[model samples]
Target: MGLACAVAWLAALTVYDVRQRRLPNALTLPGAVIVLITAALAGRGAAALLGAVALGALYLVMHLTAPSAMGAGDVKLAIGVGALTGAFGVDAWVLATVAAPLLTAAWGIVGFRARGGGATGRIAVPHGPSMCVATVAAVAVVVI
Candidate 1:
């Protein structure tokens, strides 16, 4: 059930981010709640849910320090990833951190080239979708 939710969330994020370049808080915020509730029922609430929320909050603080680099939506979405992957331990975090941006960067390159454009500051690819892909990939690596 958890994996299914994660997959669906990733798919939604990908479509939303690609088309809108924004990850709605409406989606991410409720997701964090669901994960938290599930983690609590699983007896891993503190570590999985609270910990993830802390991580998300920390990311927000970091973003505040460097708004030019990260966006608020990414910070909120990080909480969702943390909630989902937190159950698996630090490895989940590590995998997600590494994979999401890498995938996003790679995709951005191809996406831009396909549109007959080059990378520039004006073109900002949403990080949420990349994070979503990375989250799924991370889960797959951890599970199998």
Candidate 2:
């Protein structure tokens, strides 16, 4: 049940971020609450809490130091990702965190290449899809 909800939330977030290039507080805030509540109900509250706090802190620092790279919405969405993956275990949470930026970087490179290698401007790539994919991949590994 928790996993399903998490997946659904991720799907919605991915679509929204891809379309708008922004993660709205309206969705992310409520999604965080749902993930946390579901985690607690599933008897993984400790792990979930730890993951949320750890990832939230990590993203917060990134946002503070590199505002242009990380957005507040991404920070908020991290809490939900942490809660979902953390419910599985610390390994899942850690893996998701590590994979997200790598995935984003890889995607950005692919996109850059696809657009021809002559452009030198900064491209705005949505990080939410990377986050969602990493979270789902981590969860799948832990669950199966």
Candidate 3:
């Protein structure tokens, strides 16, 4: 049940981010609540809560230091991702955290090269998709 909810949540966020380049609070806030509730029900509440706070704080710091690089929405979404992966274990959370940035950077590089290599401003590559992909991959690692 938790896994299903995580996948569905990721799917919805991915679609929204791809289309709008933003993850609205409407989805993220409620999603965080749901992830927490599910984790609690699954007997991993403590770890999930810890994961949410730790990862959220980490992202908050990143956002504060570099607003252009990490958006507010991404920080909110990280709470849910952390909660979900943290339910599995610290290893899962760490894997997802490590994977997301690497995946995002790789994708950004591809996108940059594709755009003719002549831009001075930030390329609006959506981080939500990369986050979702990393979360799913982390979950797979834990499950399998």
Best by TM-score: 2
Better of 2 and 3 by lDDT: 3
**List of clashing residue pairs for candidate 1:** none
Candidate 2 colliding pairs, count: 0
Report each candidate's C-alpha RMSD, comma-separated, in the order given: 2.5, 1.1, 1.3
lDDT winner among the candidates?
Answer: 3
TM-score for candidate 3, please give it. 0.95
lDDT of 2 by residue, 44-114 (tens): 88888888888999999999999999999999999889888888998899899999999999988888888
Please give the distance, in angstroms, between residue 138's alpha carbon in candidate 1 and its true position after superposition: 0.8
Steric clashes per prediction = 0, 0, 0
Estimated TM-score for each candidate: 0.83, 0.95, 0.95
Q: lDDT per prediction?
A: 0.79, 0.89, 0.91
- Model 1 residue runs over 4 Å out of place are 111-122
In the predicted model 3, the residue pairs found to clash are none
